[model samples]
Target: MASPLKVVILGGGTSGWMCAAALSAILKPGTPSSILDLRLIESADIGTVGVGEATLPHIKEFNDFLGINEAEFMRKTKATFKLGIEFRDWGQVGNSYIHPFGTFGQTLAGVEFQHYWTRAQALGEAASIEDYSYAIQAARGQKFDFPSEDKESIKSTFSYAYHFDAGLYAAFLRDFAEARGLKRTEGKVETVALKPDSGDIASLTLASGEVIEGDLFIDCSGFRGLLIEDHLHAGWEDWSRWLPCDRALAVPSERTDDFPSYTRSTALSAGWQWRIPLQHRTGNGYVYSSAFISDDDAQKALLANLDGAALMDPKPLRFKAGRRKKSWYKNCLTIGLSSGFLEPLESTSIYLVQIAVQTLIALFPSSKPGEPIDDKLADEFNRLIDIEYERVRDFLILHYHANTRTDSALWDYVRHMNVPDSLTHKIEQFKRRGYVKKYRDGLFSPPSWLAVFIGQGVVPHGYDRMADTMDDATVIEKLADMRVRIRANVDAMPDHADFVRDYCFVPPAKVMAEVSK
Candidate 1:
């Protein structure tokens, strides 16, 4: 048989190590029939952009695939459970709502629950839509429990994610990868050499005069795109017109004893502030457009709004909202910041990396030894990546475009700015009659769209004809019943903080003592 494929990954933060750990586990490095020789290059001198503390539910699947014990991982990373995101003052000055990780309510008689709710709402017999979601109720009550396996139970309706320290999680994955026969080199790359004929990456020269060659190269380099853009010149497609927040200031504050189980995104004067509650500290940041807000003011705002005493000074970050023209180019693939950066409004940063790794494994190139890698494989991979990025872009745009905040120029501009036709169509469909378009792949099932649409005061003018088949009184009774059931189930769950302490508590004192060692 031919020799195993040599795969080299550059950079070593959350993205790089996640790729390393997942690839090494699935590709099987040291066995007689090993399919891959995995290696990673990262520098101790370089610092990573590690402020992404909150995540979506998909991360659970990634950890399970790596055979990581949840309790151990949580303790190591100081993670806390996340039910969903709570939006504040998006629609208007005093408004608040939650975009949950589960359904709003069960469908009734071949019609979506939204239509029935809409019909009941018009008759003045319905309550707020938030009442029907188990996840929203649990998050609001500061309660959490693992979803039940029984489908009939209201407790089984919701799913969960986590808020953890990005730096520590990367270290955790580094240990896992290294223990599984994955080689790691400590140095900075000086130059990337390309094959004269095929223009594919031939090898990398480290600053220390060491040369490393591989059949495939993965770029996890944070915004610089060292290999994908700096070397290969993969073009960037900027989406700043719609997503104008180009700068951020992140800092950690003292941990709070009464932290909630969900992330909080409050609309600020110029942009927005994010509060992510991890076990050790609360992650706080302000994402704003440079045109609307100065860096100094942004920093001050973030520091002033923190819930507890500041732990450290803010770390400034700069990024454009967009994706690479070709995520997979020649013999190199780009993941994480190198591929694209959609701001963490919905905490999708890690989920994007997870999806890229899974998609690459599914479409890994196949060729005989000494044969050229197929361009068709690259084409398919890029096509899939485009679908994922575009879908996520539209979802994020919905949050800004649907808002009615007139307190700031930033809000005014985004509220009236033209959006992508795809997003416009979805909004129009929902407005016409509470109908949400479904996708075969990518983020945002119907429930997510419903949450945002209804939350932002984009109420529909009509109901689906199918919803009319049910009696109005009957629909109202069903909606009330769902609210009661959701409340009953949510009240039974333990307090989020108490549950976390029992499940995976790692005292800050213990962590500091270990560091002191």
Candidate 2:
């Protein structure tokens, strides 16, 4: 039998542990036919960038794949249900809309609901496009409920994610991964040695003078890229001109009484502020461009706009807005912040990590002795990771480029700045008609684009000709009916806070005790 593949993951926190847990669980590390020998190296001195608190609904699938109890995970992570994200003042000041986890009204006669809504909107007969969405209604009402399994039911139209403590989540996964035969070393990597023949990563030397050798290395080292960039010299691609938000000040605030079921991204001068409400506290941050705003001003802005009393001093983070030239270079695969950063505008940081881990597992390489790791596998992996990053990049850029906020130089510059041809084509297509580009796989689905386009005032000049199949009066009636049904359904659901209390409420005393440990 071929020997098991030796895999060493650099760094810990969310990405490393997630990879560890998933790899250990799926590959069955110590079994008779064990395919993987996995270990992770992290240090007490090196801190993780644990600011990612909001997540996409895909997280549930990851957790479910690990067979984790949802309620228990939530309790341990201090999580709360997230229906969608509510954006304020991105299109223009005081304008608000939700990028829901689900679709708007159903397709009509092979034409999208957006086309029909556009036609109705032209006639001034339809309400805001937000009216037809079950998720938006539920979010607006501060309600929570599990999506129904019945596809025909309106309640089934929406999905949910979570707002949790990132630090706690990593710790939770650490326990999980360790239980499944993942060996974790509490030391920092001091140097990386490369093979003279293949030039791939040969071994990692720790500060404690211990050397660990592995066939494959996964870099989750955040921003620095550690093995992927520093050691392997996988180039960087700078999207700073288009994205430009290079600095952030994140701080936790006291928990508020109002427990909404969605994250809120409120646009501010020079940049934006994100409010993510967890079970224990509200996660708040001001993501701003250092070139456009001073760090001192950004810190003051974050403190002034918080929903509750500040729990801790604002923690500053600096990053560029782009990705590595190659996510998978040679034998090292970069995941999480190491691969790239598109900011957390749409809560896609965790999703990106999840996708990389999933993709790596899907295209897992051979472990046979004397056989080279197929370059084709690495090529395909890089291709997929590139697509995911580009898609997310375009989506995040849309939030800034489509805005009309003239109050700050940051907003003004992004409003008129040149974007990628791919994004420009999408914008033009949507504006000409209510058309959204479809992807066979990856993110920023039609519904997500529709929400951002319409929400940000990118009104269509025409609708799909097929939308005219339905008479004007009938379209208006159907629109009104959808609104009524969504409103009624959301109203019937339990309050978000109440639902959380019943489902996964973590006591403050318990949280403190756990933290002390």
List CA RMSD, all candidates: 1.0, 1.0
- Candidate 2 TM-score over all chains jointly: 0.99
Q: Candidate 1 lDDT, tens digit per residue, 289-403? A: 9999899989888888999999888999999999999999999999999999999999989999999999989987676534678999889899988998999999999889988
Residues 309-395, candidate 2: write the lDDT tens digits. 998899999999989999999889999999999999999999999999999999998757335689999999999989999999999
Cα lDDT, model 2, residue 202: 87
TM-score of each predicted structure versus truth = 0.99, 0.99
Ten-residue stretch with the least lDDT total in model 1: 364-373
Model 2 Cα RMSD, Å?
A: 1.0
Q: State the number of backbone clashes in model 1.
A: 0
Reference-based lDDT, residue 18, model 2: 93
| Model 1: residues with Cα > 4 Å off, grouped in runs | 515-517
